[model samples]
Target chain A: MSFSRRIIIPLGFVLLIGYYGQAQSSYQTGLLPALNVNTKLNRGWSINFKFESRQQLQRGIFGEEHDQDYEYVLSDLALVAGKKIGFDQSLAGGYLMRFRGQDMIHRLIQQFTIVRRYSSFRLAHRIAADQTMSAGASMTLRLRYRLSTEWPLKGQSVDPREFYIKANHEYLNVLQGEDYDLEIRFVPLLGYKFTDSNKTELGVDYRLDSFLQDHPRQRFWLRLIWYRVF
Target chain B: MKYIFPLFILVLGTFQPLSAQLKFEREYRLKSREVPPAALEFMQALPFTKKIRWYREEGYQRTSIEAKTKHQSKRYSIEFDTSGQIEDVEVIIKWKNISAETRQLISKQLGQNHQRFRVRKVQIQYTGTPQALREFIAGTSDESRVTIRYELIVKAKTDGQFQRFEYLFSEAGEFIKRALIIDQNSDHLEF
Candidate 1:
């Protein structure tokens, strides 16, 4: 197949899907900014810290002919220690602190990741489980599975100052107070590696929460992330 | 219609896999400043430059520097040693560019050397001083003044095993050197 057909068709498909879904669901636009710092201590040991801020549109979901207003919804900071267990496999454990509308929650998380490469792209699989605790709310346990893929737009590999694309989907199962709910998320991102130590990503986060109060809730958020390596 | 589109997208997006053949090749990008000044200066002298990229490759014994660029609708790659000395300059060429005699010689050599082999890539290379190349590229010197070689990437089956090797041959298709690739590590995970 030609390069144009391989690229243009898939991109057109993604845009068509995004446009078609907006007409079906109550979609709200939000903003997320995140910073991630990674430090490698040795061949197997690594440390990472991440801070993210999430803001939601104040108006109703998909309100027309109105001024755009945004309000802070939540913020989170997390620290993780990771160790390589096998080739292309790693295990990480972390602690996260979240602040949402004057309420705080502490979470403990463990994750396992496996990555493999193909001709011009890479595939990553991550499975994680976390426990969340709050002063007044019930304790919650969540399990998540995410599959991600990335491809370089040029050359054999993604070089410095080159463009790439990433697409990922995640499934979440939440257990709280004898009740369980499920969530699914899709993200399509465009990324650029500015230098060996710096990179940026911009994407859309589309999430659907099923069985939330017996009704499905859909959200669309704009996500921007920065990565720095030390 | 409301749910069908999303369902179709979800199914298609989640299951579609990249369909392409992979070779045992990789590269690590380097900064322009990280390249040796003398080599960079020589390459920049070429005309109609579009893009210049630097890479570091640890092959066989020493670390080699590669500067890849596109000029006049053709790809040019120049290799240099640690001290900015020119190793070779290679350009993308068509398969028909090799003479019939040279092709026959190459096939005979491959038949004698391996049970079976497949060609993956080919490049026309020039081995000479940086100054001579600059003058040649600048159209001030004749092409015959510089020595030309052929670089071929082939997957050869030897002793009932298939392995990829980089092969160099003289203009007359006489075998010169062959380098075996031990690993395909391109710093893919660091970023």
Candidate 2:
């Protein structure tokens, strides 16, 4: 097939799927903007900070006449210290202070990550454990695992001014006092490498929260992140 | 039966068989700082070369530095390692420039190794130059003394699968070695 045909075919199928698969689920759209900074303290240690904002969108991206109604859902600041373990592994611990409307929560987080490379694709696996605390709410413990893959769209490897694609899937298990819940999230992002030390990503974060004896709640999130290294 | 055919198409589309692949090449320019100092020094020492530029390339375990320059009527590319040791010097040449005897010999070898083969790109390479490298860097040697080699990038079928391979041969068309051309994947450093 010709180059134009190759692209037109898959795109045509996607449009067909969109036209036919119109079943709507119980989900809310959220927009998140975040800035992440990593400052290297030494050869082995680095500190990372992220400021994040979550806004609950009242309408979809295509709903133009709705006047862009949205509400500030939550915000958080996270700080983490990472230590390089080996060529392709790292260990990190962090803290998060979050405010959802009027309620505040604190979290302690620890994680380990390993990355492997395979012919134009990078695969990364991260495991994390955290504890969350609030004034009147019971303490919560959560364990999560995420697997991600990244590939350069236009070159053998991503470099400055190049575009890449990253996709990840995460599973989270939470225990609050005696109640247990599970959440699964999938994110597909397109990223641009502005320079060696800067990158930007735009993606959709789809999350499904399942609780015992309750119908699962779905969250569709538009996520944008800016990453910088110093 | 209705579900089986749709499922088959989905599976076939999602999981591509390990057969022939589409090959592509795209070069990214690197900053001067990214180029190793040793590779830069070696390039500076070459005589009669002008309009030199440097780049760091992917698709290799060790860092590879590529320097392109115009020497008289011909354009030359010299690939070096991080330590400034020369890997190969290549000059792009037309397919007809290759002697018919050598081309026929290469064709026979490819026929024996693969079910089918097609040549895609060709370069005349110079190697076996440890002594020549030292003398050249010291500004005491000429280019024509080194042994010439033919380096080819070709698509070939093997084990019922087709993939690109880089083939190395002597000027006499004796096969030395061949390596499957695979991409280099690296994680952008987080910090």
Candidate 3:
């Protein structure tokens, strides 16, 4: 089969499944847009600033009344500092402030990452721990591990004016008060590199959560991300 | 809230013109059919028949085709011109594979060049006539007709900053030239 067919067929199948699954499961669809800016410092240190916003377009429970009205959800602003620990490994810590309606939540994050480079693709593994605190709520602690891979659609490496594919699979273990749950997420993105330090990606961010509950919830977000490095 | 959209657009617009000054370097995989017939034929003449992958590299004012494979547990990379003529063959080897004298000379050069250095990869490169190269690999001929060189990927601390370089040395360990290896942006992955 041709390369385009290989990619297009699976993507179409997933979208079809998502469309059909709406009838059998509770689903929420939204738009997630994010911007990340990175700056390098001396002595192997770097800083990153990120802003992300979520806007809901549809929400409903299966077999019930569905709401189609657009709603603004939440936005997050984060700042992170990282230090290179090895040739392909890094350690980072960050703080994120989330704005949802009149409430503001704070999150602290620490993570370790390793990036492996192959001839055709690059794979990244990340392990993270985070604590989220909100007004009038107990703190929520979560542990997460994610594996992501990126490959050039045309060549061995992604270069300026090139397109690439990036996919991420992540598992989250969440604990809040006396309750615990697991959430799984998968993100598949098509990216375009404008320069060595600039790129954009568009993709689907799918999440399945509330695993320990009687009813599970699914979210499908059309995600757009822009990354800039200096 | 209404002004945010326009502000974001303005910010993006300001960066668009800066992209023209950036550099471009890329290496991508190629199918067998995309490779030149001469290059494919050269591979066919080799005695080792393991899985071979082809790649096309563009950057630095040059374009070249490379074939990579593993034979007898050693990784081999053969580079060819765009027209499919053989340029050189490189086989991954250990530092100990170099002769004692050559190793000493190489160490001396590296010590003088950097405050501290570590070799990440070492490859033995061979260049010769196509026929001679094939025979040399097949063990049918000696090294008389082939020119041998050592290629090393090294990470060294120089002037308080660490950088990665690709170094080329003669078979006898005389330093020839070196080029800095540019690293790709990993902001997306790291953050």
Candidate 4:
């Protein structure tokens, strides 16, 4: 398999159910943009309401956008906590939920993520299970190295903010009687932060699929994110 | 790609300041000298008081002041045998760019908060990520730096004289909790 052909093979025809939860362009997102509202009730607990009204705009691995018509509303309550073990051991976790009216269909989901930070970069492993009998896992390996020239912009000081561009890659492998598999995203990002809590990110997303040599489809988007105090 | 240890080092180093907490112990020491009538007359008039004992750890600020009263008949010890007695006295004054005038003006505001705000061991905490903290508050964040300052302070009066009027005027201004001392019986101090 040529490199591009290998990449598209999975990008075009993905296994029955496989999503790494990248929060990027989706077959259902173009028609129904989603709204997420989260607030801090106190210290350890938080409530998040999600309203998604768009369909996925799947722009095959390379060519045109394929409209995947679907919508659902999801309400997720999360309990987050971090524990430090010994001198070099630490753990951070989030327990989440999905409700009906949040995005379109009435479905529930549970996702668990665990990460380990080394001297240079952090590695993440995530597992998500849907109401249906489909279960999947995603593995992401990203390298974050600090750059010197970038100072922080105004409006951020309460937390330590760092500037680094990372190379991100994800893979999803599923099993259900037969191999319905493959999809991957290769993104190079130019990211910056204001204080420590606010973020401004920009990047290019390159995708590859399975069947029609999942054509190499790419796009650009900007994202803004804020986290509540813990 | 470089040293994985360095990345873990980065995260661990960020949380260092969270544990550098401050502890305030209760203690105080008081001294006075009468030029002619008032201070002397007050000491002399006291009945059955023992003379002074010059001690370093007894709460005296300096040995020079301790020497001034050494062997002098006027020197006397005032001891309050309570468990939380003023063990040592220190006056720590912090000159922050705080709006003292603004706080004074908020007297009415505090009155309106009669239900929400109550007196207790006050601890003020600020939580946010370095990147976001500097962005939300103007001039707070570096281009991509994180390390915001969080501070806590405890203050009490020098004499515990909450009700009286005159004790408030003494030149002894200090952060009573961290700097000054008070006797539970000193009706002149307000905390």
lDDT of 2: 0.72
Q: What tens-digit string does per-residue lDDT give for candidate 3 at A32-65?
A: 9999999989867899999999999999887788
Error of 2 at A75 (Å): 0.4
Question: How good is the docking of model 2, as DockQ?
Answer: 0.05
Off by over 4 Å in 3: A1-25, A63-68, B1-25, B28-53, B70-74, B94-118, B156-162
Determine the iRMS, in angstroms, of model 4.
22.9
DockQ values for all predictions? 0.05, 0.05, 0.36, 0.01
Error of 2 at A16 (Å): 18
Q: Tens digits of per-residue lDDT for model 4 on A55-117?
A: 334333222355433333233343433332211222334343444442322233443443333
Say which docking band candidate 3 falls in. acceptable
- Please list the residue runs of candidate 4 whose C-alpha ends up more than 4 Å from where it truly belongs after superposition: A1-103, A106-112, A120-123, A127-162, A174-179, A211-230, B1-19, B22-191
TM-score of each: 0.54, 0.53, 0.81, 0.31
Model 1 segments more than 4 A misplaced: A1-26, A58-68, A211-214, B1-191
The number of the candidate with the highest lDDT is: 3
- Candidate 2's displacement at residue A7, Å, is 18
Query: What's candidate 1's DockQ score?
Result: 0.05
In angstroms, give how far residue A25 of model 4 lies from its true place: 16
Please identify which of the two predictions, 1 or 2, would achieve the higher TM-score against the true structure. Answer: 1
Residues A42-123 of candidate 1: C-alpha lDDT, one tens digit per residue: 6566788899999987434333453456778899999988876654567889999999988999999898887765546777
lDDT for residue A170 in candidate 4, whole number 0-100: 51
